[model samples]
Target: MRLLSRPLPAALTIGLVAELLFCWRLTTPHMLVFDEVHYVPAARMLRDLAGPVNIEHPLLGKTLIALGMLIFGDGPLGWRALSTVAATGVVVGVHAMLWQIFRRVRTANIGAVLALLNFTVFIQARIAMLDGFMAAFVVGGLAMLLWAMRSEGGAVWRRWLGGAVLLGLAIGTKWTALPYLGMAGAAFLLVRRRHPDLWPGLPALAGLALLGGAAAATYFATFWPAFLYADQPLTLARLLPFQIDMYHQQTQVLPPHTYQSNWWTWPFDWRPVWYLYEPADGAQRGILMLGNPVVMWGGLVAVIACLIAWARGRDARAGGIALLWIASVAMWALIPKSLGFYYYYYLSSIWLALVIAAAFDHWRDRLRYWDEAFLAASAVLFIHFYPILSAAALRGPQSFHGWMWLKSWI
Candidate 1:
């Protein structure tokens, strides 16, 4: 355990475990689940150079999936392998960011553990989707930003450059990462106010402007693949029009579906998407995107406690977690997508998991091992729900109800 007293080693260990879980029976269902039908084909088109497919999303995610196919062959493994790695990258990035913020290996380990157990990241990783890549780059960018805040002149520039690139990649993977720009700007201003002398050589406003410019340049660069499409490949003049089309597609009115949930209900786990359910792999199986009860329910209380600690007790760690959780979740309210799903809260769920870690870290004096205790409870739920969560064989079709406490889950 003493070996994990450092950040890098602990992050490696946690990431290894996460990768194993994500890769376990990775092709179990052997068919597309949920959005994979849309994305996986697009990936194949990219892989074969057939043409543009699923143009509503940006190219980076599909490019990664196509690259995975090139390396792993066009099968379930290829469709999802890159996403699995990307999702595991999020776990490592969260650990790195936690260490930067909390500077405590134990707290960072707790954050990584919660991330591994969190329901949303796990499911997204095992599927072929854009969100996994976007989430990874988003967390990595934030981690780099934290490092940049504490570094010296040249180091600060290098890290900020890295962060800006990652931010661009995040947005390139999915437009959903745009709100993080606002979040990062607000965070930088607050951090500058708190640590006035840290970025000694750079003016705060100038630094923000530089980061934004670098991020935009990098974002525009991500569209080069669009020019490779055979039919009417985009030119410089058409990029803006292409973006306009994508925007309208994203914001266009669409009919409602059963699994769709409002942004407000996402945090509460009011609706869970059944990614897979039916006979498959020789037995009854299911894969439900339900949030863990302990993390989702307990996390709400932890967030309030962390907010109180930030407001009244002047705890910066609690404040950082609270700020990030809000930034990640709150933007969905403003998104024009009428067809929002529970997975839209994927980024916020990671921060809520961190809130649980930060809250226990703050109250360690009286709480003692309460963090470990609750994590144990959450881990038990992880196991209890493993059959459905991991596509493990069930006793029968009715087995899905064994873990379904609410009718809404159906």
Candidate 2:
């Protein structure tokens, strides 16, 4: 219990720092950038007139964006304010999740710092996107699941039900979040088997039903806005067709994008997607949604090390992180689509950070200050990539060229 509560300040501190980093000069690119063009207007329509827009995705994220716009008067900062808040929650959630699973304050703190140093987390936090909201909810759900696993029978359902609600919200934000729900279900069954006393008379099937039912109910509730705003009367017959249309729209192939890289290329940082690039006379700006190489590549290595630890010594923490990373990565690979972006690796990257943290916890006893050194190096890399990550104007073409490690990144 102390371990759970002790990290509250650490989580808040990480979140506060992330908000500052993300919110600094938040209105620089005064207009819509990248996917903001798609979702922000939808948000505006929703907030202004309760109209349906971007029906392919769920409404909660856009609703949050709409709420921000309504409260803040629809500036660049207004559009992104909720994203910034969600990103901060993600940082805080990562700290809580890591501490819950690993029970090491230093390891948890390191994972949270690693998250801030991660370019995708930092950049996605600043932009108006569903991915940030999904990431925050995913982390929060995972943390809640861990808390449930640690609880007695009396509190287990409440904790697990809370986790299910968050995961459902995650799914409502993006369908990609569905895999995490599956993972949570499997984990719940495991907890039931291993800790039968914790479940009392509840069977695993009944427990899973309760969890999944809660998630399904929450997801169905998130569609209320769409139902209310549709031209036709609200009915399952009407909604089913719209859902089918959305699915078809998503899966259909489109023209090639310059930064469209496969899931395999993400961990390698092969091609960084340029979300925004402007070459105006006095206002050259760019935002490349790529992971920091030091952290990304190093996280890949940590995944391997964690796998080795799991294979050789049956390290549960190591194994859990490695399995989670593999599952997250594999989920993208299994997506039956011709197009995917580097940011598709966002969920996997969070698990990789956990792998790095678990390995750090192991190595801290044997190798002194290596964890600290890694964090320091990661911070330096974040600084080096800030210009491109934050869309800051370059002094010249050469200033931009200096940061491009590969021609694909250009």
State each model's CA lDDT, in order: 0.86, 0.82
RMSD of each: 1.2, 2.5
Question: Candidate 2 versus the native: TM-score?
Answer: 0.94
Q: After superposition, how far is residue 146 of candidate 1 from its true place, in Å?
A: 0.3
245-355 per-residue lDDT for model 2 (tens digits):
768877888899877888878888888888887864367888888887878899988888888887887776777778888889888867777788888888877776788
How well does candidate 2 score on lDDT at residue 153? Answer: 69
Winner by lDDT: 1
How far does residue 128 in candidate 2 sit from its true spot (Å)?
0.8
lDDT at position 2, candidate 2: 50
Error of 2 at 183 (Å): 1.2
Candidate No. with top TM-score: 1
lDDT of 1 at 314: 97
The local lDDT score (0 to 100) that residue 29 gets in candidate 1 is 81
TM-score of each: 0.97, 0.94
